[model samples]
Target: MGDTGESQIKSGQGYPVLKPVGDSAICIEFGDEINDRVNDLVYSAADALNARSPSWLRELVPTYRSLLVHYDALAADYDEVRSDLLGLAASDSAAETSSSGGARQVFELPTVYGGEFGPDLDAVASHAGLDSEDVVRIHSSIAYRVYMIGFAPGFPYLGGMDQSIATPRLATPRTRVPAGSVGIAESQTGVYPAASPGGWQLIGQTPVQLFDAQAQPPSVLQPGHFVKFVPVDESEFQRIQAEVANGQYRVAHSEFAS
Candidate 1:
C-alpha cells in the first residue's frame, strides 16, 4: 500500500536528494562530488526503479552522481513521485539496494598504447612523472568498473584507476578522437564510444565499436559493467581494424563473477 519493502534504512550524507532538472523531470543527486560510492548509489537507485518500470515513472537517466527521473504529469504529480522516490531512498533490504548484488557484464577492449593512435600518451606519462611503459603498466594492470554511460551513446563512465596515473586533460582538445580511444582524466578512465571531439588525455585506441545502434544493446557497455584494456601492437591494431571494417570483429565478452 505504501510503496512496500525496506523503507527504513539510515541514509548517509551521501543520500539522494531530489531537485528539479526541468518542468517534467527531477534529478536525484547521490553526491555532490564525483566518486565511486556516490555513483554506485545513483546507478543502484536508477536500476531498481527501472527494474519495475512502474506506471508513473517514464525515464531513469543515470549520470556520474545523479539520476534524472522523468514522470508523466497526467498520471502522477510531482508530490506523488517524490514520495515514491523517498520510499526507495529509505529502503533497507540489502537484496533490493546493494549495488554489488545487481547484474553486471564485462567487456575486453584491445588497445594499442602510444604512437599515432594515442597522440597524448607521451604527454600524459610526462605529466604524471612516469615513463611511457610505466604508464601502460599501471593502466593495463587494473580492471576498471563502469559507473554510468553518458557524453556519447555507449560511452561508459568508468572508475577504479590508479590515482598515480591521474593526468590532467590537454590544454586543447582534438577535433576528432576515434571511437574506442581509451583515456584517463583525473582519477577515472573511459572509452570514447565514437569518433568525436574530446579533451581526455588518450593513451590508446581499440578497434571494437563501443556504440552500435544496430545491436540489441546499442551501447556495448553500461552501468555496473567491468572493463579491461589489453595492449596490442600496431600490426594487431591494423588487423583488428580491418576485421572491424569487414564486420567480423566483435567486442570480446566474458562473465564477471562480480
Candidate 2:
C-alpha cells in the first residue's frame, strides 16, 4: 500500500489527488511540498466546499498542503463525492481565490520571554551564537502563519520563523510543558495550547488562553491565520494572566492583507 501510494503521488504532476481515508474521509492533496501557495490552495478548496454547503459534508480540515474532507458515508456515495471534489478543485473561483490577496486575521499574543517562563532561552542563544535579547527580537519581529493545528488540541503548527534563531529540540522530552508555552523545534515555532509532554525547545510563554472547551471555537488559533508575538515584561505577563483568568482579556487582533 505504501509503494502504491508513493507512486500515485509521484505521478500527480501538480494536480490534486483524491486519496480515500477509511470509508468516510477523503484527503485532497494539492502537492507533496509545503509552502504558502500550496497552503493557499488548501484554504481555497475548503472555502469553496463550505460555501457550497453540501448536505453530506461533515467537516473540513485544512493542512499545509492538503484538505481532509469528512463526509457522511451513509448519506453520500463515494464516487459521486470524489467527482464533486475534483470539480471544485478545478473551479475558476478556487484558483482565483488562492492567488488573490485576501484579508486574514492576525492575532497579537502577549509573551514573556526568558527567565522561568523560557527555561531554554540560554541554550537557544548559545546555539545561535547570540545573546538572549537578539533571539527574542528576531522571534517577535515577524508574523507566523498557522499552517495547521495538530499533535494536540489547539496546538498550532506555525511557519515563517527567522532561520537565524532556529533551534533544535531538547535531547529529552519534558513530562509536562506549561500551557501557552512557545517553543521552537528546527524551523518551526508554535505555542503549547495545553500542558503536555513535548520535546520542543521552550523559548517563551504566552498568557493567552489558546483553547477553551466552553468557547464557541475551542481553539483561538485557526489554520491559515497569522500570529504575532508581542514581548512584555514579567509584570505585564502577570497582569494579562489575571485578566485572562477573570475572562476580561480580549485578544488583540486585526485583519491584514495576506
Candidate 3:
C-alpha cells in the first residue's frame, strides 16, 4: 500500500503513512518533519512491531520520521506485510508505545570546550553574540535529546540546543573532524562518532568513544536517549581520554523512566 494517512487517535499525533520501498521492504512515515511528537510514534511503532514480530521480518531502521522495515524476499510477501502494518497503524497498540517502548537512557558526555580540541568555540561564541565561556554554559546547560543516529556510525543526531547560541554550519566542511568532537549546527548539536568530514561548527571535544567496534552495542548512544554535555577541565579531559584509549574507562551513563 503506497498510501499516506494519519492516525485517528488524540494521544498519538502521528500523521503516519505506509508505503512500499521495494518488493521486500515497507516504510512507515510519521509526519514529514523532525519533531518529538513524530518521534514518539516512530519508536512506539518499532516497539509494537518488535513485540509481535512477523517470522519473515528482518530489520527495522528508525529515522527522523519513518521506520524502514526489511524482510526476507524469499519468505515474505509485500501485500501481506503491508496489510499487517496497516492493522498496526490503525490500532492503539502502536500508539501506546510512546512512553514504554524503551527506557530513555541518559548519558553524561564529558567535553573539553575550546582550546585545541574545539577550535571554533570562539567563533561560535562570537556569532551568537556571547563570550566563549558563556557559550559553553549555554551549550552544557540543557539535556539534549538523541533524535536519530545517522551520518556516521554511532554519530548521534541530537536536538534541543538553546536558540540563543545556535550558529550555522561552517561555510566549508572540515576534511577531518576528530572522533568525540561536539559541534553545533544551527539549532542542533551532536558528537562526531569518528574522524570524518563535516561542516557543523565545532564547539568542543569529548573523550568518550561514541562508537567502539568491540563494544556490546558498538554505538554508545541510541535514539530517544537523553544527553547532557558535562564540561571538564583540560587535565580531566586528558585523563579520561587516556582511560578510554587504555580500555579502562566506562562511559558514564544512566537510564531514566522515559
For each candidate in the order shown, give its overall lDDT on alpha carbons. Answer: 0.79, 0.87, 0.84
Q: Per-residue lDDT of 135-170 in model 1, one digit per residue for the tens? A: 999999877787778877888878878888899887
lDDT of 3 at 177: 92
Each prediction's total of clashing residue pairs, residues at least 3 apart in sequence or on different chains, is 1, 0, 0
lDDT of 2 at 68: 94
Error of 1 at 69 (Å): 0.4
- Model 2, C-alpha of 78: deviation from truth (Å): 1.4
| Full candidate order by lDDT, most accurate first | 2, 3, 1
Top-lDDT structure, candidate number:
2
Cα lDDT tens digits, model 2, 130-212, are 99999999999988988899988898999888898888899999999999999999989999998989999998999999999
TM-score of 2: 0.92
State in Å the error of residue 93, model 3.
3.5
* Candidate 2 deviant stretches above 4 angstroms: 1-12, 92-95
- Candidate structures ordered by TM-score, highest first: 2, 3, 1
TM-score of each model, paired residue for residue: 0.86, 0.92, 0.90
lDDT (10s digit) by residue, model 3, range 1-258: 011334224224645678889888999887776667677778888888898888888999998778999988788688888888888877845356546556777899999999888999999999989999999999999888888898778988888788999899999999999988999898889999889899999989999988988988888888888899999999999999899989998878887775
